[model samples]
Target: MSFKQPLKAGAVIATLDVGSSKIACFIAQMTDDEGGFEIVGVGHQASQGVKSGIIIDINLAESAIAHSVHAAEKMASRVIKGYPLRDVVLAVPATSSESHFVDAHVQMMRQNVTENDVRRALAKAQVKAQKEDREIVHTIPVDYVLDGHRGIQNPYGMSGQLMDIDIHMLDADFAHLKHISQCTEQNHLDIVSLCSSPYAAGLSTLVDDEIELGSIVIDMGAGVTSYAVFQSGRLLFAGGVPVGGQHITSDIAHGLTTSLADAERLKTLYGSALATISDEHEYIDVPMVGEQNARGEQHVTRALLINIIQARLEEIFEMVRQGLEDSGVEASICRRVVLTGGASLMPSIPELAQKILGKQVRCAQTLKVKGLPDATSGPAFAVSMGLISYYTQRPYEMPMEIASYGESKSFAERFKGWFKENW
Candidate 1:
């Protein structure tokens, strides 16, 4: 299931996001308008068996997925009863993700280029992207070269003897992906496509200008902080650090001698990535770890909590900076950075990220999608919304390796007039 069937009116799409802190599921159906969709159901459960995007306890992970999917199904039933939730698009973390630029050249068969020519070049690179242990997540075209001249956007109508394409290849760890597959298959759901969470986040968060001009998207999940780079209206790279919001909560638990639950509550209620002098005077109740509920309560300044949160977030941003430098993308391409996901909800996250990374930073949520409740429209559901958006994109084909199943048939039916004219 490398490429999904192109979306059309009445086609249903379901997505699952397995994160370190939570597991979420969304069900949506394509609208009559082209590239328009509306969310019909949403459900997210606290993650139980997954740690750092790896499944440790198979049973626990399966159970969590089951509950999440069930809730989403229940909600969707109101709109369309008996909607089958069998196939789904999966969102995986960007841990161990890799990116590359490969060139594919093809000599034109006819005087005027055709869409088939472009597909052939992309298919050629798709063949080259076939690896032994890595699973391809995205194969995107960045540029077009025609007749030895670069920067050709569309060479279809012009005369060109030879054409080449610059393709961006993205892949992820096979073992990590397999584990999630096994767990999902156990829940009776077939995996149709797997997308890196950061790439998915970029689709839902970046506006048209950001996607066209160039920008970076950072998704601060519970277990991993993943990033994606976009330039000239294409995805350039994706990578991640092993630290995220979960670590900050852990730090708070250790520093303040509180339970993980209470630490999470504190982080949600009063956490800040940037601490201020006023925080020293603000006091909050901290329940002791060993003592009983009422007797063990103690008053501590919010400054201590902010310090712990700020220190850990700084390290995360530092690692993200090092990652971008190692990615080999030019600093000029990433004019601004956008933050999303669960952790980006903290106060002053944009300020802290800007200070540490030395780039313009802002927090973002899922943009332009409809029917998502307030709970699922925020930064936390960026990846979930992204999977829905990914469903609407034109599916790239790797003809030599993977077969074109439903997508080919659907395309033919949808464009029968053009096919008849060309043939």
Candidate 2:
């Protein structure tokens, strides 16, 4: 394996995960040495600023962001009074995001892979990707193919007559980008870099072997079901459907004739993705909104509740299966699917996902971090924890070669800044 130099350490890095259910803030200190980062602080608040999967209420979302960040800063015992924590690694949901795999091959000027050649090949991919209405947010190298032999992660230091690249390029609608930037600017926070939420979660939850052997990480978040297909330690494809755990709650509420809050409470306490009639022992209780009996008691049967929850979960898994099929990376996903995110915590989700996708499924959690309490380090916190890994694993050096090749930095830089600063 080739070693890329690590980013500067000792600096405080914060990550913002704005999702349908909540906005989470994570702050960590990168160690100067090669050890992974330490979680110095964390914060989370119920999200009121988003709907389905996109940011719809800017002011509310901004307030949520500010509150979460402030809590994190306070917990870390640091006063972020200056600059308002200008730099952040912001996680963008796939709601308004687009991803396409693009390849570029460049004839080698010499028999060796120089940094210049790699830069030119990547730039070619980015230019080709940004040719139309969308702007490229990330151009990550999927793999490097030198001559006839493939499977090269880093072609530099290897001898090759030509350098070929497979890149996963992420883009967003121009309007979405502008709106996000304006929203952050209004709050005096600049985004440093924008990372796809699914991709980031995959980085932390997926093991090296899983990526090499081909695996799918499915993030069953509140407002969206996001997925990433990984192979050879790179993201091959990522997409998100509009359905998520929230939809399940809504389905239960509608199907059971219950209030939203009651639906949510039932989902958390009694939801099951794979329920059999035999599992029903007794009737469960679901309170009626603004209506109570003489003893203030209301109840529903467990089997009825499970039926509603299971139907919704099955639909979600089917949607995930369709998303994997749409990615068209490989058929290997049939054997490997890792379930994550808040919804995955449901007791029967793993078995249900396995049955639906015909894959071995398990809930994923962040590993190789210290001082993370168990309560906050499960699949539910996968995205927030994964952001820490993303910040630590990213190469520190600027893509100077891409700049020297006469590539315009205004759009990419501004977009990257928005990602880096807003977290």
Candidate 3:
């Protein structure tokens, strides 16, 4: 029942990522040695009833989740009918997520600072961050100032008269969280923890140097493009833009007079974020929309398709640049940008990102996760794999309290049910 404990050797962990394009499930076992973890099973299905990373149709979303979980279970040789899967770590996109800074000054009672003093300061900051309707998803202590000396990583057992602490907290829409929880519950899964998608993707892709030197990780998914800022091995900011690969697909469909499926195929095969002179000679057969009488096929230059994709992608990068500026993080810290996710696979996307974002840009694939299939080990799977990495590296102490669904059931009743099932 304790979520704070790390996954021990031989312990099993499951992660579920519900994105606008797909629902991914992963099952892994902690290795006995430093090999870390092994992917026992993996499953993914085309996302349905979800739009812009939000669940719209509960039944359809639940069915998609169930199918994904079942597929992973079959691969792992675990059957849900006999031994039910109970808990899962969920990855959620930060749609409309906001960041806030909370500062607290605590007068130390004793001569030396202890764990209690640090805890008290964090608790006071959390109190100040409390809002009526918002749910705080992450409460990270960015820096600790002990007796006017700042940037102390850990203040415990230090001698100080006063302790000043600054915390970065991320808050999400409560209604969105409730809907996600309900959908997972419908599939008989209890959410053990939640991690932001962009943050997770960064963890899975960025190298240690990239994190320490400060960088931005942009996850361009099907329906939403999310980014996270990291510096000194901690997440500084997270935000998302509604436009993503799906929007590009729709634009291609409209611009070329083709169906959605055909547009997607073309986007995958011939899409490029930057156009060259040679593109004019490269032609693609585009299907005409609503043409039923032998006028279905049309020839279009690849340059046109690249133009359409470039327009939308430029806008996306511009939005990201503006978001970073609004956050007030210096451009120097975010000098490097790492692009990931499905949409980032388009040719020359890195070049386009560099031109628009004005940063050194590179497309990243997911870091190797033990036993992960080569086909499934790509940038698109970064978030799901990062969930596993997060669990393995998380501290023993739990930080923020997850917001409840505001149910009418009593605490005793809920605890009893959870205990009975898990114990």
| Per-model CA lDDT versus the true structure | 0.80, 0.73, 0.79
Q: Compute each candidate's TM-score over C-alphas.
A: 0.89, 0.89, 0.90
Which RMSD values do the candidates have, in order?
A: 6.1, 3.2, 4.3
Off by over 4 Å in 2: 1-6, 78-84, 131-133, 148-154, 294-298, 331-334, 366-368, 373-375, 396-423
Per-residue C-alpha lDDT of model 2 across residues 166-213, encoded as one tens digit per residue: 777777776665556666665556655567788877887887898788
Worst 10 residues of 2 by lDDT: 395-404
* Order of quality (lDDT): 1, 3, 2
Q: What's the true lDDT of residue 53 in model 1?
A: 77
Give model 2's TM-score versus the native structure. Answer: 0.89
Report the error of model 2 at residue 215, Å. 1.2
Cα deviation of 40, candidate 2, in Å = 1.4
Which of candidates 1 and 2 is the stronger one according to lDDT?
1
